[model samples]
Target: MAAVPMDDPGRTPSSYWAATAAAGPDIPPFDGSERADIAVIGAGYTGLSAALYLAERGFSVLVLDANEPGWGASGRNNGQVVAALKHEPHEIEERFGKERGGELIRTIGEGPDLVFGLIERYGMPCDARRSGILTAAHSAASLADLQRRVDVWARRGAPLRLMSRSELESQSGTAFYPGGCIDPRGGAINPLGYARGLAAAVLQQGGHIRRQAHVRSIRRAASGWQVMLDSGSVMASRVIVGTNGYTDDLWPGLKRTFLPARTPQIVSRPLRDNLRKSILPVGQIMSDTRYLTVGVRMHADGRLHLGGGGGTAGADRPALYEQLPREARRLFPQLGDIEWEFRWSGFMAMTPDRYPRLFELAPDIAASLGYSGRGICTATIMGRELARWAAGEAAIDELVLPASSFRTLPYYALRGPIVEGTVLFHSLRGRLKTPG
Candidate 1:
């Protein structure tokens, strides 16, 4: 196996998601040569879902991961299954053109339904809630931007509603938010459970999942493609690289296409009955308009979950845990002296344009990454599309998302400082605009 990186506080080795998810199959690592119709690297949602789809279609598929499935950001994310992207509608139109952009919008708009449908199809017991997602505005400027966003989606026939300050008070359990928009189509899920469930479904479909099977390299071969593992190699007609954020040098400069940002999350001890009812009364998932985003939700067991505080890429910051509780207290002052139960971190692949990209690296090798923190819904949908493309059921150009040429930042080594400095500026801007 490719040498796993050493543990770091900023890179959480375990999370609440893993602690709660049901035990998954102990699929052993690949030890020798194997032949398959398709070889998939990275056992996160993207890889597992692709394998599941392809295997169901009667293709021989093998998925290899350095660790157990969902060990990466897929299980460590904030768990909000939002159907929207960070890209503004006009921005998407400008980049992909009106015709393709409209298709892109329609594809992403179906993300939530795709996620929940898979959950139901498999009867996966992942504490999923389709109670809608609320985006609160931390400042008047952001509130205006959110209103514009709602108008765009509203015209598109989305079940979106704008809430006044008074209307948000009960929904958010705080009067701090003046106004915002809610998308009834979005929801939340136990991310780790979802990933594990995907793994189970993949296995049930006759797919192979090999944990600790790190892929070292991929090279084109006369037959198709050859994937080099730690001990043995696998030859296949097709290969899929789904290792977002945890992407390494296996595919040459793929890691340089985006910055891997670390987001720390904190979970509180289960709240009292009255306290839980007063907070997120409707049990809707929430996030605010601040540049440094905070996502809040209540677990099925009543433990309040809050995640945010983007920082330098995996550089240990002792203040992360402290800062979260302080911020949470500010948002819900009534809950004083709250006890934090868990603290962890996850890496998000952030692109300059804030849009996910699919790249056809070679004739038979493909990669999809850079979800920019909107992976849960988008990644699952991308996997299904990828399966269709891999199985030759769809053409490259005919895929819902067109493939893009890979581009890396110049002097990519300096992205850490660039990303950190940019986030600092935004955090300051957000603080100045919001009321204390």
Candidate 2:
């Protein structure tokens, strides 16, 4: 791991997420004292989702963001609306106990349901297609791992099927996979469009959303929680912090439990319709089974988004991302003629348990962050649940990830180097490599 600037050059949105997505209507920052039933400290999916549910419940809600809504990971993700758990359910049951852990498993598997349902109900223009996700195994041992996952999910009544090499190659664009697993409930979408659409829906529901209101500090007030922005202040009965990897200086030690990582993506120039169809005829999105997975999706517009590997400001970013074009050429050699267009990156938070944390920082100030890389769907679902909880309408059982508490990472000051080193070694060794 190498040290780099906390901020980077042009770490904002780019790639296809920007091209097809519209910027959210700008909302002014908080300028004066304010009161609300709930104040959400982010305008990403988590905050927006919380606000949407809060508004529907007829609670007064205000959302504040440092930048435009969806400018964070919410808008700039791989857009793979996948629903399968990153870990197995039985393992979840083992860790958190059967009752609570099963609930968590069910919540995550239902994450995509919330996303697609919102898309249909709101008529969001995010290219919300309901196809399955395929995760491949590159080696025979990896195939055994897939078999274990298949058995585990099947025993838990999940709809998963393991595929042979032929089936894997058919679903994927190339013969890069020996085998894989498919989730019928999985899908993909235009993430930026989805975020913008959610903001619009939140506004239509009479919720208040403000941008450029970077929260400086959050403390408990005599009545509830006091959120102080750089320019203004707000008091709310409940506070929801959706800052995730950007959790930053607002809260000490919390961010250390989760590793902040940057994943890069590339979008090729649009292709011939025939070429696109040949690659993803069924319009499915795919990723590998490696610890750091590479997720790819063929768009309706004859383009593909290539994503995998992890790094950030502190570590030497991996060179694997540059291998995308060659990988794509292997997948569809005919794609050699298509010119490459945009390449960009976004940061995400990861927990060692590979599940998100939803806990209270104070009596009334709750936070929902640290989704690892499953942000596209999980963050939205967590946001909704967080809203319900804040409204006093939902219980801890509503949480998707087990809320069983653990000690915070021991060394807050040293976590970045520690986590980055661990990830860097495995990332380079390809020991964590997924089947493509």
Candidate 3:
């Protein structure tokens, strides 16, 4: 793993979302002992959503975070609300078996509905748009894979359409993609605003969120669990850890279970009306099929947001983001020398299988993390599943993704060099236009 310093809770990154989103709710840091039915660590989307649902179910929920809600990847993400996992529907069924896999597919496919439904229900101030999401194919192999995806989803009555080269070029305003597909269920949101909105909704539902409450350890107690903080302790019957990529030694070896990959993003100054009209005119978010996926989207205000997959460590430097502008120019050559105004990075936990996990760390302690690059929608739905399990409405085995023992990724410590090499290999392959 990387030797990066922990994020400073008091300082949110100067990303575009932080600058444009509304102010987060005024939350005080932990100051005194607290007790609740459930204690949640990390107030990202998963924790906040779980706390909100648990609070709604009349459980006393206490959420503690090193920083304010949405300060981590939850706030910094590109905000594309994709509804499916990395695998195709058939691949999922082949892996998890017919029954469980079918259930998982159905639940995951409804992820966008859960996200958009929450926004509508809470009347969140986030710029929520359900315009759609496009997956552009960078190669012929990728295009064929997309065709398979479209066929499977179409059989299931999903609102997905495979696009020809011309259609994709027209919609994305770029001739870079050979083909693509659009999932109308997916869309975009102001991620920071959405996280803040979730925090507000949790508070409104009587959930307690304490910011700057760095949890030092979790120990067993006669009552249940004791979450020791920098200045206070929280005792609850159960503990939920939703730290994702910011995960540390909070739980023994939890950080080793997944690889942490940094994703860097750059935002351009709002484009002129003519340029804006020429690019992504349909208001859809897009990501290509490259191994190092490049994500692009248009802000409601017309700023061009582009992100690239960073290596395993030390991805916070400005120099690491220089390629983004080049990529933007490659996609939209007409926008020559556009001034990029914001550059920032966040970590996403990558599991071996690229699927998020629900792990049973202890008798009453549950942890969920490793969203790969699909945190917005997956985390929201996972939080509800966690809430159901915590509330005893469903057993862990009956959850959508059953809780399982942690299987630490082998060679986890060497991830830095490993990821760098993999990135290099993929980059070379992509340059050569080799099959994926």
Tell me the TM-score of each prediction against the true structure: 0.95, 0.91, 0.97
**Number of backbone collisions per candidate, in order?**
0, 2, 0
Question: Candidate 3: where are CA atoms >4 Å away?
Answer: 5-10, 434-436
Residue runs of model 2 more than 4 Å from their true location after superposition = 1-12, 315-320, 330-334, 395-400, 404-406, 431-436
The residue-by-residue lDDT of candidate 3 on 44-115, one tens digit each, is 999999999999999999999998899889988898899888888999899888899989999999998999
Pick by TM-score: 1 or 3, better one: 3
lDDT of each: 0.83, 0.77, 0.87
**lDDT string, candidate 2, 1-436, tens digits:** 4232225442446568888876655577667778899999888889999999999888899998877788777877789887755776677788888887777777788888899999899889888888898887867787888898888778878898999999877767678778888988889888988988899889888899987777878887788888888887999988898988767666656666676777678888878876777786777888876676778888777777787655553633546366667657765676765677887767777777677888767667778788888887788888888977888976755665545353577655576676667667766665434344
Most TM-score-accurate candidate: 3
- For candidate 1, write residues 1-436 as lDDT tens digits: 1111213332325677767877766678677889899999998888988999999999999999887788888888889999878876767878889999988887888899999999999978678899999999888888888888888888888888889988887898878888888999999998988988899999999999888787889988889999998888999999999998888889899988888877788898899988888889898999988868789888878888899755556454576466678778888888888788888877788888778889888887888989988999889988998899899998767778878788987756876677778778877787787756
User: What local lDDT score does residue 33 receive in model 1, on the 0 to 100 scale?
Assistant: 88
The model with the greatest lDDT is 3
- Evaluate model 3: give its lDDT: 0.87
Where does the lowest 10-residue lDDT sum fall in candidate 3? 1-10
